[model samples]
Target: MTPRTFSVVIADDHPVIQLAVKSTLSAAPDLHVCATCSSGKELSAALATHRPDLIVTDFTMGRSEGNDDGLRLMQRLRQSSPATPVVVFTMLTNGGLLTRIRETGVAAIVGKNEDPAVLRQICLDALAGHRQRLSPAIAGLMASAGARADGVASPLSPREIEVVRMFAAGSTVTAIAAYLHRSLATVATQKRSAMRKLNITSNADLVAYARDHGLA
Candidate 1:
């Protein structure tokens, strides 16, 4: 009998990074690259068209037709393709953000600084239904950040983090409220509450904070 092959979809905005990742994944005999996307929209379309067994993607892919930020993309992807596990490729250093990504139930996360071979191993592991794995750097960050890595002890609720991310992307409070189906007062309160937790006093600082955590 022929060996079974697992199909994969790779998403990244950078042409060079995309090429490198495709090359790495394609080198594995049991894996096949079904599609390569440069944006979240393209990725979604590819997911619908190919329905690959695995997804290897960057945390952020610039502005696309849909939500492409780290956490929102994960949420949308989960809703759209519940069975297809994901493997994130990123350069993120923020423990809170990494924790958020992990919570999204990704199969694995490999930092850009890690060995390229790690991606292949992670891909195979994900397809095998193995437990999730994080690169050394990501694990170190989570360990160093301690139990506070996630919002349970970290301060910002998942919804509040979404608000801050939208705000950083230039969405006005009213616009965010409308898009989120949240009342203006509630949106404002969430933003203020997030800021207060982070000790952010201004819009500029909040944006900076978001950027620092890869939220922007």
Candidate 2:
């Protein structure tokens, strides 16, 4: 029996990085670069057309037009194809960014400055069904959040808890509506209610509260 060829799509704003990644992956006999995109919109369009097995993208792209480019792309991919593995190769190693990426269900996170061999290994591991890469900083953040038990518990209604959990899970208002079988306006209302109950003003705060409460 013959093994299936793995098709990959590369999305990054930098042409040089895109070329480098394309060159690196091109060396593997079992891997194929199906498409290359320079923006989140292009990436989404390519994915819709090509349906690649894996997607490698940077953490930010100017083409997202003032949004967390890679994160938005990941969310779109999740909505369109939940099983396609995504590997984020970026220089953004901040704990908050890492946590956000993890919540978006990216298969692996590799530093752009890391050895190419390490990046390749991570991609290979992801192709073989591994998920979650623990950088020391991300681990420390997770550990600290675990130790803090000051988040809301037992007082919020089940709907409120669901709203908070979905919010922490990186679902936008529309996504939450779809997930909960509610209208967009209803979901937004629930989100606001949840925030008011927790006295949080931003998604980051909501995520932190959820993390502290072990809701994520």
Candidate 3:
């Protein structure tokens, strides 16, 4: 069987990093960058209009005003399309952040400080169905002092689980509200409650918890 041609959407707040990703991915004949977004809101809007095979996103965007903007976008994406792979490339390499991102079920994690070629290759491998963890150093730290040792699965409610799954699939809050037929504020409240229950202080942390507990 022929492999499917993958369409990707790149989401990063940094112009330089966005350009770097675009330039690198452009070299691959079978991969196409269908959209580039600098904020979670922009990525959410693009995903509503286009269904890409994968999403390559930054963990944080200096340009975003909303809370945990990048992770929110990933959650929204996952909510809308669970099968679509999302790869996080960012500078937040601390064990705490890495643990949270893992929970979000991102296909791969690549540090910004790593070689651009290496990052690009990781993305490519993820598109081909491989689960690439963070760099050896990052992984070593996580294996040592991170949530893996905590052994506490997140204490998320079924509703929150539902919210997270939807978030991960790429459903916007508005979409989520509409789908659940609840008010926006109510949906937001429930999501927040879930985050609090899990002791997740940020979207990155939420992602890590979800990845760790297999909730995402």
Candidate 4:
């Protein structure tokens, strides 16, 4: 019998990164690059059509048709393709962004600045249904995040913090609800509560807070 092959869909806005990732993955004997998409819209379409075993995508792909982008895109994949593992390949190093990404239950996260080999190995591991893996840097961040959680008595719940982080990263309320599986009212309530806790009266204030906290 022929060996089974794993298919991957790579999504990113940068053509150069897309090409590099494709070339790297194609070098693996059992891995195949089924499609490459430049936007979240294209990623969604590719998911529907190709149904690849795994997805390698940037954390932020500019908005495209279907309103899929960044956190929203990750949420859609979680809801629509629960079984397919997703690998976030991006340059974003924001702690808040990392927190929000973890909430979406991604399979692996490899920084774009790291060697391409790192991403390739993560891909191979994800294909095997192994537990989620975080690169050393990401693991360290999570460790510090935990310490922060323990030492700081933040007025906001982790969920609320995550929601604010996504909003700061450019997600709309509706998109947040869709991604987090919260009702519109629930999302709004959390947003309002987060703002109130931080004494933020406007979007500008919320954004500024996020930036100050390295969430943006």
Candidate 5:
């Protein structure tokens, strides 16, 4: 009898990274790359069409227009295909960001810097319904989520930081509000408050702050 094959749907906005993941996963005989997408939107459609056994996606997939597009995508997937396990494959190293992702109940959280083989193994583990695993980097971040220095304390709340990260990742305020399920006025207020707390007077400064803090 032929061995069973596990289908996977991989989503990332960058063409290069998408191709690289497809190539890496294709090397595994039992792991089939059934669908590849360039954005969270595309991934959602693919989920409806393919119903793959696993989902491997970037935290920043798709257009930056929807700042929380990636997070919202996860929500939709949880609602639509709760049985399929998800692996967050991202380069994000922010502890706060990882904490938020952890709340989504993903099966695995792997950093892009790790070997593709690590991801492959994690996928296998996830398919078997094993306990969730995190990369050492991610584990470290999770262990230190709210332990910042008093002198260097960040003024932005977790939600405000999320808004900044989304904005830095290219999401517009309108998109952010919709994704977060909050009113436009609320989103705008949070954005303005974040700016005020950070003393950022311009978009450029905000972007710089995000970059400096490894948010974007």
Candidate 6:
């Protein structure tokens, strides 16, 4: 006898992550990618259309991020489909922010650092009533999240924060240096340091982070 098919809905802003997730889940005989959405608005619409058995989503989604994208969306999911299990598929490692994720009643949390195949196993486990599980790559993340449940604290120093805000707001590195009366080298270094602290190696990702943090 064939097992009951479980349709899955995936929501992420990145095409690569979406593709990876779709590919991973498609390998499972009983799992199906019923829909994929790139934004909260789209996810809401997909939920209405597909009414999927499981949802895999990200904390931030495109330009609408920092708009209470996490908590509010999770709240909506709970209200709209409380019985459907939700699995957070992300690469975010902010301990404090991850704590807030746990409060949202999601069924599971899987990091991008782990093989997407792990998500498949965790997805099956979540269906069996497990609340959450963490992979080895980010196992300590939740511990930190648990210890600092108060709230997310900024990792950037004040200078780094200033540098990041200016860069994100379209100020050129030279311009920011001139305006702040700092050497170009100093300003540039600060910008690079900030990016590193945020785990962003590319300018595009930095801009996305800025948008997600309301700095852009």
- lDDT (Cα, tens digit) per residue for candidate 3, span 1-216: 976678989988788888899988878877888999988777877777888888888876632234235445556667877888888886653454456667767888777777677777777888788864565545665666544635332355445665765665556777777766679998888878988876777877766666564344
lDDT of 4 by residue, 59-161 (tens): 7766534746667788889999999999998775565557667667899888887877888999999999989878767766656656232233346776687
Query: Each prediction's Cα lDDT score?
Result: 0.84, 0.71, 0.70, 0.82, 0.79, 0.75
Tell me the lDDT of candidate 1. Answer: 0.84
Candidate 5 lDDT (Cα, 0 to 1)? 0.79
Enumerate residue pairs that collide in model 2. Answer: none
Name the regions of candidate 2 deviating beyond 4 angstroms.
64-68, 134-216
Candidates ranked by TM-score, best first? 1, 5, 4, 6, 3, 2
Task: Indicate the residue-level lDDT of 26 in model 2.
Answer: 79
Relative to the true structure, candidate 1 reaches a TM of 0.87
For all predicted structures, in order, the TM-scores are 0.87, 0.62, 0.63, 0.75, 0.82, 0.66
Give per-residue lDDT, candidate 1, residue 148. Answer: 45
Rank candidates by lDDT, best first.
Answer: 1, 4, 5, 6, 2, 3
Q: After superposition, how far is residue 212 of candidate 3 from its true place, in Å?
A: 23
Which pairs of residues collide in candidate 5? 64-170
lDDT of 4 at 202: 100
TM-score of 6: 0.66
TM-score of 4: 0.75
Query: Which candidate gets the maximum TM-score versus the true structure?
Result: 1
Per-residue lDDT of model 6, residues 78-183, tens digit only: 8888999998887767554455666678887788888777998888787767756656555577565452434344677556765675677677898778766689
- Measured with C-alpha atoms, the lDDT of residue 205 in candidate 4 is 86
Worst 10 residues of 6 by lDDT: 62-71
lDDT of 1 by residue, 1-216 (tens): 999999999999899999999999999999999999988888989999999999999986675346465677888888888899999999777676678888888888888888889888888988999987887767887777763433432568878987887899898999888767789999999999999999989999999988877677
What's the residue-level lDDT of 75 in candidate 5? 69
| lDDT for residue 71 in candidate 1, whole number 0-100 | 79
